[model samples]
Target: MEVMQKCCVLFKPDTESKEMSGDSLLEVQRAKRAANLRESLFQILSGLYGIMIVILGAVIPITEIFMSEEIDSTFEGFYIYLYSVSILFLVYVYAYLLRRNRLKTELLTRTLSRSLSSSRAWAKGLARPDTDTKSKFRKRMISLDVSNHHTGTFYLRLGVLGFGIGSMIHSGLNFGSFVSVSGGDCSEPVQWVKPLIHLMFTFFQLYFIFMNSKMCIHRYKKLARFGLVHMCSTNICVWFRSIVVETLHVIHHSDTRGHHGAESGHHPASDNSTHARSYPHSAVGHGISHHGSPGPEYVIHDEGMEKTLVDNMSHVHHISRKLLAASVNASGNISSASKDNCHWKNMMSQAVEEAGPYLYPCTIEYSLMCAGILYIMWTNVGKRPRRPTRSELETDSEDDGVEDEQRAQRMSVDCTSSSRGLFLGILLMVGTIISIIAFYMLVNQEEMQDSAIFLTHMSGTFIYTVTLLALLLAAARMKNLSFHNQQEANLEDILILISYTGLLVFIIFSLIASILAETSTMSTLTILSNVSMLLQATVQTIFMLAGDRMFAATEKQVRKKPGREFITFLLISNFAMWAINTFQTQTPQHNPIQVDFYGPEAWAIFTHISVPLGIYYRFHSTVCFSNIWKNAWKKRKHA
Candidate 1:
């Protein structure tokens, strides 16, 4: 039997250098439980705060009316400004991500590391891995195990931010909406749907906060040390520092750097630079030059210079025995042979494998929690959208350096399929516009409003379908500008047309089932958002499946970049949609017009879809970055 033990001691200084024997995984589990409990407290606090804020917003109007003062100024001063700050802060996070990405690419091209290559193929026929001359960091990442991956940790504290905001502002907005419904006489409106939506969405935000909080605590605790009190875990600080503040992971992934500081991106000898033309193609290891140094400015490739860290296994078995005993309460100790073999090694091996990857919780888990909250809050797919920041597109993109012309050219997609889909979708869109127009016309007018309303119903439904298809067409057009395939432009337009047509038809029926409340009641402007989220998820799944199959057929030889535009649109649309619904439900003139955006029974479907979607998208981007980091190490060698 192999007693549980640590394999390494960097220095033989006895007690201080002992191998890690305690159950770190067990600690993580405990952290998760603690995070959940804290989240529950936050939820309670958030609920109370939301109610207070809502009350404040509601009462201020009545207070102003009594005090005989201009109430609008107070709202503009505090509510609008505060809300704008939070929204802008959210936008800043995204801008930071894009900036980090460009820097990451530059970094990877310069980084070099000792971990860079293998000859005669390491995995044999099982995996057609990248060539021996490729950056070593990329090699290590491909063989990475799950649990080591930094995605999906924030399941506990997902919706807290929104919950807190909603609780604080919901009542104020609701009362204001009531005032609007009552023609500003400081009287409540008779509408039941808006109040219902508010209550339901409050619960939804609570749920989101709970999930992310839990995941955060688990990940955060991973940074805590085994013995010393207040000996800060480098992991927590590094991850949070980067993600929330500096975007460290983003840089690491763009271009991998080595401990010794080596360039990780492709390098070819200056001599060979003239021999081959074009990037990716020239760097690709199909041909070798006779007189080239390792390449570009410097270096060379050699198999014997490389080494695998997992070549020995005396300590792996020991670690496995202890972890198993801790997790499962096993009676018998693990055997040495089996430890070195598959029997005991499998679980430990899996853990060991995953240890490097799941270093931090990523964005997918964060989004899933949000989606879950949405699912809990609403019966329908639509919410009043925040007035689309029509001006934001002009200013923000320039600062972020995203080209307006590029976006415009992409939007003006030339293919008939894309335009035709929009055209076909327009019939559906017109119906929606008519419905919205009819809704407003009814809001102000008093003549037989109820009777004429039903007359425009079918038109509204058709417009819902067309609007969805139009957005789908728009999203696909954005996707094509990233790639360089001639046939793909036509194929994508066709695929988008078909996909939208199918989705539009499917989602319209879903709304039919949700006919209890006129989705228009929630927010007339945001009806198109439903189409956006659903389509984004579906498209991602389709591509992921395709990528999987492609890799399977080629044995990991698939050489395509994942869809960047789709991911960008998918995330912004999803998050912005969720966050902006608050803007939709609130009217600036009133303290806030109250309505529930996330309800329990129906919208939980969105939550279920989105939480996982957000988490995966964010984490996957991180993982993709991990693959991109190719450390440059020539400086250390020269030193």
Candidate 2:
């Protein structure tokens, strides 16, 4: 019998005559009122925060373009719509918190600590002693992906709890919203945005410190598995904390699928075409819910159903969507055209090829980047007690040779980037410091309105865009579809031109936005530090895209390699900024007097672009997988 000491669970084969009964599991899985109380406090604060984010996200745009007459101060009127959205989101969040807490307390086990029924195992009646440990080929074909830890789940949950709350309030009249740069009535942070942001950010700050903070008890060499590191300050600690939280998020997602059938009043959608309004496909904001061992399964029989999941995933470009479809198809619940699609097969191969190692670096870099997020004045969690190894932290820009492939094919991996990122960042600083000079040199210096300035903006934006394209081109030259795919007989190449143009635009637009914002010349950059902001907006997106593909590739079958799609999203969103231009100030103003007053308005909607929809998504995520969540919780509780 398997005795899981750490898990605190015992193993037994039959549940029919067990020490713990199924009723006990239900009791273990029941939600608790005490936890509901905790959730209530969180909701009151986060609800307010959600209201604020709704303002920032929703109101600002409306005020900018439609209600331009009320703009006398900062974060003005941003609360009107923000409050509304916050109320709605806060309600949902609080309810969810209540449900989840209940689940935590009452979780139970179905059978034992070990011995899963094998899908492909032969009749056990005549079985002899088995010595071979070789994993079956079919197992590889059916298993869902559990790699990459639970970064997305943990991070998003924390983010939803933290930024979801803070951003909401920041958008509202909350204290987290703004300051009086000009000392005007509205310039001081609004009262509305205050409580929410404070409560959420307080939690954020606390967790940011606790997780990343290390007390140096001992230091081991690079490969030492166990030891301690000490953190005494908050400098660069936000980044450390945020990244650690994010990493744990990934672990949580991978550990168990999110709770399936999570809905207040909705039932799981039967087909792939329609989506749940609450959870959507996966969790909101790319919260993935995986089934089986691998991500998406390639059911080889049906065509229409297979395409349904694939197309949905294609539309979103998220890892979990595709994984879900694959899982469903593999389980024979959907069509099988997916397995027949040549391009889809090729994409799966290429994704595996590139992503296998790319994920390591992304995790490393993302954690290191967290330093900027912990912008509080208290502690420095990222501080190294001793030298961390390249393997331990692929975060350092200096580290190379992370993998031992050493083969010529592998040796030529050109992950080498411009290395000019720092220098270019410096240029942005110089321009910002001497922005007055920059303003003076302009034809409409006093007005801050120049058509030529727009041209320069467009041109500079173009150059940055062109450079992004160049890298993509080099990457394409480096590799191609490797699975020797069989192109679908019915497949016709879509508008290749549109696809390429759309992709290039995404990479460039965000790249430049970030570059222009980092004029702050402080040793400690704010969490929204100019460079860090730029990285978050542009570099982080790129990393997430890469991370998704790398993570998805571990499965037996894949739909499309997502590297190219990542490039496309960048281009499209960049092009989308034109919508903001509709309200660019015509008169001279130091900065555009853009403001909003409400939540759930247009801008608020825009901020929620990446937020997923569907009851399934709210409950079932790619990680913290919903399918196993019930059992895992039950097992833990009954243990």
Candidate 3:
């Protein structure tokens, strides 16, 4: 009887080992299949990236040169080319997304049918010995575990991007109207098409992103990778194009301002003599000459008209000699200008040009937002979902329960705890706004320009210094808090580090220029601002690193956390800095010291490239700080 019991136990051990071996074999097969898919996906992605780089490398410079050469001769055809290509790319992506969604629906329907059939078979007891294995294999083939993890960018950022796209559409329509009415060499069909297509693309693309920004693609992995990567590359190209166009516009404006200044300086007496006489004729001539080639037959030889043209030569110098002659003739017939009326066209052109500076930043920001979202999507393609362990599942449920309890209790923000920081932040914001207003108002005046630039640097220096000190104090207070390191770095952390490099580049360049240039008020201010920004960025990064590791403290220990107020203050301050950088600092006039030191072309390129990233850092930092503030004081769960 004892031998018989022993034999039964030995048989039980053998059966258990067999079952474990089968499961291990299945897992190994699944891993091998995933590895194979990953290898193929990578190869395809590398090929796509290589192709895009080659195409952009060959196309951008050629298009730029063509546009530069044609600028004086004709209205911009570059915009037409740009919008047409963007429209094509957007249309392709739109189609793919729709088709992919449809296919996924069909696949899901088929999977449900199979699952139902198998359930019925089991209910009837018609299932075979291997039925479970076959069903599991089929499920793996038909469905994937999908994850929708937060990518750190908040909906507020998306709102900002939408605002920017709307601004761009408005600007584009104004530009299209100006071109269409001016009756220049710009094609009639193309004039309206650019803005209309831009409007359509933005509407659809924004909708798609809002819907699917967090979706991780698990099926059709190859096609998903290609489409996502294409979208990312296209957005990056758009960003690059925006920066180039903005830089060129700034340089052109500076040249115009410099020429106007030179003329005003050299002939202060002539301005009084011809102020009234030349005003009307020059305005008429500018309107006519800006549109198209006015024929020589339109020239009239009136003495007053000729004098008006000569007095305003600096403004009309870019116009061809034929156009100059035509403008002289048009000025004589200014009273009878009904035949070639341009009043409406002139007003629209002026409005469009005036709005460009404000609207350009929006488009730049939009491109960057799209690029970041698309890049995240690209990385998420084919990402396998991780299965949580039993312990993790329990922890998550407990946390959710805690959150529900807090919500039921009607928990509210602890404003009293952060009152000092909030008040100080408000004051700093008010002072920064005042400085920005003063700088903008005085920047164009020749005598006040230097002082305006100095004021800008000084205000920036003060903000950076204050923020740096606050961050340091917060770090010191939080140094002893209990926390744990993340097992792996996430995409948000990687992106923040990458964005910080952009600001670092700008700071290093500024420091080098300041050190190299002769000592002056502006240079001294630059050095101070650069040092403060560098230190602020470093300390802020450390704070973010520390914040991520921090475990929520108990209510009793919450008072010791100490950085919530500082975090609130830093958030508002960073936002204030973002606004200042976007609207004021990016302008070439505001950075005369860098322009003078690096020369116009080099400086323009440097700022256009780095400033956008710096702006993004400030904007992104606000989001990060807001997250820290929200999570820093949550109640810790005790084991």
Candidate 3 structure quality by residue, lDDT tens digits, 117-203: 433343233224267855653433122222233343343345445555754555464445434454433334543554565556556
Residues 81-165 of candidate 1 have per-residue lDDT tens digits of 3233333432432244223333223222212111212211221211343566245423221111111112211212223343234
Encode model 2's per-residue lDDT on 218-256: one tens digit a residue.
111111110011111111222222222222223223322
Each model's TM-score, in the order given? 0.23, 0.26, 0.68
| Rank by TM-score (best first) | 3, 2, 1
Q: What do the candidate models score in CA lDDT, each in turn?
A: 0.29, 0.27, 0.58
Question: Where in model 2 is the C-alpha error above 4 Å?
Answer: 1-148, 152-448, 477-639
Name the top TM-score candidate.
3
Error of 2 at 624 (Å): 22
Residue 272 deviation, candidate 3, in Å?
Answer: 34
Lowest summed lDDT across 10 adjacent residues in model 1 is found at 630-639
Task: List the candidate 1 regions with Cα displacement exceeding 4 Å.
Answer: 1-221, 224-414, 463-639
Going through the candidates in order, what is the number of backbone clashes in each? 87, 118, 1
Error of 2 at 333 (Å): 54
Give per-residue lDDT, candidate 3, residue 83: 46
Error of 1 at 474 (Å): 17
